[model samples]
Target: MKANLIRLGVDIGGTFTDVVLEKNGSSFSTKVLTTYAAPENAIIQGMHQVCAKAEIEPGAIDQIIHGTTLATNALIERRGAKTALITTEGFRDVIEMRTESRFEQYDLNLNLPEPLLPRQMRFTVKGRVDANGNVLVEIDKSEVETVVDQIAEAGFESVAVGLIHSYLNPAHEQLVRDVLAKKLPDVNVSISSEVSPQMREYERFNTVVANAYIKPLMASYLGRLEDRLCEEGVRCRIFLMHSGGGIISIQNAADFPVRLVESGPAGGAVFAAHIAARHKLDKVLSFDMGGTTAKICLIKNQTPKTSRVFEVARTYRFKKGSGMPISIPVIDMVEIGAGGGSLAYVDTMRQIRVGPESAGSEPGPACYGRGGERPGVTDADLVLGKLDPKNFAGGSITLHGEKSKSALMAHVGQALEMDPVEAAFGVAEVVDENMANAARVHAVENGEDLSEYSMIAFGGAAPLHAGRLCEKLGIERLLVPPGAGVGSAIGFLRAPFSFEANRSVYMKLSDFDSQKVKTLLCDLKREAAGFVRTCDEFSEILSEFKVYMRYSGQGWEIPVELTEEQAMNPDAVAFQVRFEDDYTKLFGRPVAGMDVEITVWSVNATTPSEKVEPVAATDGADTLVVNGARQLYDPATAKFVDAQVVPRDEMEEGQRTAGPAVITEEETTIIVPASRNAIRQPDGCIDVVTKE
Candidate 1:
């Protein structure tokens, strides 16, 4: 980014729409309640607010980067456009009949989610393409035209073409698309080969269906946003953050909105990775808790881990396989329905249970006084003295403590036969424990230890509970960076312009063909780099190569990275050695006799990463910062303690404060538990470490 160029980063979350404006190494940020009906309204409002703070006109903005949750929300709510799917005759049930394995093994009355398109909506054509890219059965033009006529008569807003083995050979799918375009020119179309060019009929078909489903919704929103921004005199090239922790041109984002499903969380991960680089931390845990959900990601060596697949809208208690799987490059993380607005209730087992449901910003938490009666995490925090009733959102939205107390008592206290404070404690503990368990599971899955990783907490609600969470996870240190509440928006600015191109070609190490491998890799590089060029025509682009490999009998594969040299000159022996090294690190050892096979190959082309200046730890003498004290609840001691209230802006460098304190800022507040102490670092980061 140019020092003098003004950049705007916007993140539309489930609850809040965050905006950040940056120029000449300075930034201004604001948080506004998300406008569900017109999410762009919030963005415009927040943009003006930040521009006012920065003392600049909206027209002065040089660029805009954005990420939104509309795609994920549309799929989760099942409220996308009326979509129809066309597939090979026999594979019509591929989406309906998901993988055989049940997410929960012992539940006898388990129920799988229904397919996105019902049987009536999913039409089949007589077409077949084998796994070897052979055209076994070609579709008759009249038959495709017949199917298209029915789709047009049914008034589908979007149509998805997903034939069997479309990833291997897209001719049939493309033919279907051509027929649809001729019949229904106005209707949107998405093909599996373009949305997700990979194997697995179920995943590929579902991915295309999802893209088509959300196509109209996202396209309309982006178009409206651009028009409105231009109308407001904001003349800037708009970019979008993709789920792979990078930026892409708006044109690319509009074509494949599924890539934006995890965009907001991906930006948060990028923000944490930037922090990790500045501090030179090898291992860091990124925790982001907003109003509707909480996300946890592991950052190692200043980069967030990447994955080719992840689930969205998990239907059963955030179970891995219970949600729609969209096969696209993304930052790997575990997100659960545990956030500020996550509602709470007493379960049938006489235990307090937190959310997979949220109150959202329309009604918000009970304390928001917007007609919501249920007690959520925000209500519990208010009852527990973790959030100030009068100072929330910089006093823009005043909270009602009595409303929270009443709601908590009615929903949880009476059922549990406990007081409001006790009920609030139960809810808070459950929320914290749920997030900790998720973090632990994610860490164990990746062969990591929580105790060895430092925590970087952000988002509007994370810092309030991060202290207690660190205690539970046995983490010793936490860093709350500036602009923590709007971390994702800031991350959007930090991300590079990039794209990942993926293809599935079944091959075994025993049949090593260097020439074929070289061609495939080169083609992938060109495809991925071409997308990046659309974002920045002149910036130097770097290519990253990876292969997903598994043993012959295994159902899944792990990603193994390869250098350009290694990819260009493929060797069977070298492939085995690299696969085994990564495999041994993950599973302790690799099988000696099993043959190794590659399922998917990927190439990511990205702009060169920005250089980072290491943060010099503040070594000046520590001075305690305390202006007043309030009765803040101490979860560890199960009692109320007089905690100091320190204004963050007034705190000087090297200033230190013991636990039982609250560091107050405009966008958020950091709660320092009694068991730990905090110090203001040279870079304006609040470092929270355990008391000696």
Candidate 2:
């Protein structure tokens, strides 16, 4: 760590922009509503607030690490620049066709997501590259010129070039980019080979298109943010958090904005991992609930699970293959629109249905007193006495209880023939069950049991329902760390400067090419390390290797970790043994006499994470006192009870508070349910456990 260095971390979410300033070891944080027109405005306001709290000037900041949902929102809302896709001849519809696998097999009326580029926007060139990196048909310059003319006439701001088998050879794609650049010098071009050098044309093509779609927007926003920060006298290097839970330079982020799709949620997972390391927990689930979405990630051995492919804007709530797939490294998690601002209403079945729709920052919830008339989860929370209307968001915005009641009664209560409080209970129950179902599905898909894992809750809205969620999931322990409301921002500070580079190269174990494998691994390491070097010049960059392996006829592959030495010196026997071991772990047993094939190889270059001292376990809890009391709804008893309300700042290590209680903080509040007790652990974490 640099001595006396001041680091600033900002996370722009759907509803709020969180800013955290760390000087020496102490930290100051603040949350402000996100400005949809210009996100940097919120960041600037939040920075000023945190700086004032820290009693420092903006110029004193040494570094700024940022994570945002802008790129994701742009793609989901279709607000990106006018973009076009160029692909190999006869393959223009690959993105729309989408592998022929239906997520809803029984439903004949299943609706697939539309491609990012329509048929008119997707153009094809006469060029071919074989799977073995052989050029079957050379590029035609005149044909490229014709496409370039059409693109120029269409006023496209960005173009995506994705030819068949371009992952193996980029010659054709490069030619198209070169020709297009020569003709349209200002347009941004993204090639599949450079953006996602992996197999599967549909995924690779869609990934590049997504990258191209958001490139101009992210680049302009980042440039504007840089200029504004400079005007505020903050002279420091800026980095962005990617979806893989690592930090990359602003230029790299701008170049491949698709990598930032889950950046904010990835930070929350990183924060949970850090807390897990401190507590020495091997299995933990990260629960992050912000204003617009709730994310659940499984953390094992103090590291969040990572995946190569991630889907965004899922049309079907919990079903896979119903969204736009982006083949980029990302922290694996399940996200649902079950947040504080998620709107709630009664459906035709006379049942309460919570969102996939959010009010966001413009109207926020009914309690925000904005123009929104629909009741949201936050409004329900306020009506249930789980949130204080006067002290919400640090008193920056006073919530209106009357507005919340009116909205709930009009939208949900009247339909269900219940009062506002009863309607609020129904809404809260539906949202909580929605989140719980998502978590359960995620765990079941991963073949894990929720009872064995501890839950780490963060983000602004997580604590308010974490205890109840744990009760629903049969989870015994829950940890809410310090700065839980701005956890993602703090995670931006803790993340390492790193990057992962991967490529697809098929090789069977029986016909292992040692030299070729070594070469591929070496190239991947160099590529990953090169990006990391841009962020940290002197820190040691550690390399981690993984290969995707599966049976010869399997559709998908499983990741098998490889040591640096194993990757450098390929041993067929050792590789097979590791593959079988991992395969057995996932499927209970490996297939006998079946040849194993490797499809993709990956190398992650990262700086070593900061070390954390483990917290010593305690045997007995100390006595506690009730600071105050408030009427809180108890779902189990279906009534309101006077619960102890305590300020978080006043609690010390080893202090204990019995449930039904509410632990209040400036950023958020933790509601200890009637069945659980809250204890302040040694590491400044509130440990909520079921009462015996």
Candidate 3:
């Protein structure tokens, strides 16, 4: 008999490698410092530890799902392969021209992010397809051979082909790809029609170029990971999380690597959604703070809000329009560099500024004793008495407090003429405020109010600073779920095997074609379902439809939900009614008599969500005793206070602990601030509520 079937989830973060093992009804997890050279080494080590504790062999694992920050890191570090872009002749300037909007309007020395491929690397071919899906200029086959020779001589590892209006007519793009394969079989190629089938030349070109830039890197890493896993006696299918909050097969992920840019953060959002569903919560703000960056995602009614386009590597201090736009389905969220390992420094303005630069796993933080001299947010937390130097990561790695103090005092303390402790508090507070402000801006931009949403804090550092952030945002309640350290990994297990299929099919509601729309929707359903079938063998599949619509002459589109029956029988009146309803809900009102047109259509097919019923309340202690007390700086009091420390496992269900407490777990710590109350929930979560 099989020893015991288990499902494993692994997340490789910038600071730590987290693994969660689910066998039968129980779960076990382990956290280890991430190895930068080979992230898979940390995963294998953590897996071995967790399985050993559970007394199971590696072969007993039935499935292993993984999420990683590698793709995002490659984009941020500019470590991807040398890439070339082939676009329509005149459209080579589109990526640099952008939308003619400035992210920073007043700065005279504003520096936009440099395009991934320079003008010389961005070549154009003799081909033109009009917006109406008509061939304006036939692609010159002879010209293609010359372009191929130039690209080959340029030593580009990959190439992106994006012709004018290729989303409407992909014939020329396909022919170019075929010729390139014939000329250079080893060169990775991506086309806009296949990578991002949408309007807007800049976004489509950026997406395809980004895909090409990362193709070689992702392909090599994925192949090595698969081989290593099989060598470790794990014979199971591997799936990767997509930015759309779904799991796709490795093949698909490799082909469209841009979709994997936000894949890890998307998993964290899914994990928070699952926890919200378990507690019957309708609105939640998922906060994930890892080592390299912090992300905030909003979930309402058990679904994370999805966006069709997102940016990568924001250059102007995380401002919109300062980054490359990639058209893909992704969970909408705001990501900033305020994570534990985010470096801090005093800028030219003599003001403290936290990162967009991080030490990552290689040097990590000064406290980790990894030869990092610059202070990080983690070292500051230690100096502020927020973290137990000896108890971090369940004592797997002991932090050097003196080193942390030295780094802080040498870098920030001396400049401000303040002691290390005060500087630490200042750093912590500033970073906390930065994250809170980002959360507020993101929510307001999406027309949401923080007071109406509960906060779900996860990741290694999120639980540490969540209470303070909640207070700053005026958020009343926060939930710290179990397995919070590897929340994204747990989310990978929760994600369903699904795929989103999108195509550019322009249609005006005023002159809608019901039969044509019906046929298109049917074809999309089959396309999406076929992709999902490759990952899951289940006989049942469910699908959802969406249409990207905009007013006539508008250059952008917003997503509108469509039911299966509605897609099959798209009546103009009914379509307008649904469109206006959604429009009014978002923008308060719709322009009457304005013609609406659908620019793109999308379909998502997936397995059903898993059922996780709420746990019933049980008789338990009302108050829990503390293990010890420590001096914690209370910002409200402007002084240090004696805070109680309690081990999370020792707290019984329904146990209540007042504010000024530190609940420690093996993976992370939960800090309940002075103005809040913490309660132990039935399902091993710490619920924090504001004081009346």
The lDDT leader among the candidates is 2
- Give the higher-lDDT candidate: 1 or 3: 1
What's the CA RMSD of model 3 in angstroms? 1.9
How many clashes in each candidate?
A: 0, 0, 0
The model with the greater lDDT, 2 or 3, is 2
lDDT of 3 by residue, 1-692 (tens): 13355888888877788899989877889888888787788988998998998899988888887787788788877889999998889888888888888899999898878888788889888878888889988999889989999999989999999998998899999999998999999999999998998888889998899899999999988888888888999888778888999888888888888888888899999999999999888989999999889999999998999999899889898899998888998999999998999998877776778887887777888999989998999998887677898888888778898998898888888888878887788788889999999998999888899989899999999999999999999889899998898899999988888889898888898889888888888888999999889888764789999998888998777889988888878788888888888888889999987999998899999888877898664333487777688887787786889899888898888988888988888888898998988888899888998876
Please list the residue runs of candidate 1 whose C-alpha ends up more than 4 Å from where it truly belongs after superposition.
Answer: none
* Model 2: CA > 4 A from native: none
Instruction: Give me the runs in candidate 3 sitting further than 4 Å from their true place.
Output: 1-5, 616-621
Worst 10 residues of 2 by lDDT: 617-626
Residue-by-residue lDDT tens digits, candidate 2, 542-657: 99999999999999999999999999999999999999999888789989999999999999999999888999855337857965999999999999999999999988888888
TM-score for each of the candidates: 0.99, 0.99, 0.97
Tens-digit lDDT track of model 1 for 407-448: 999999999899999999999999999999999999999999
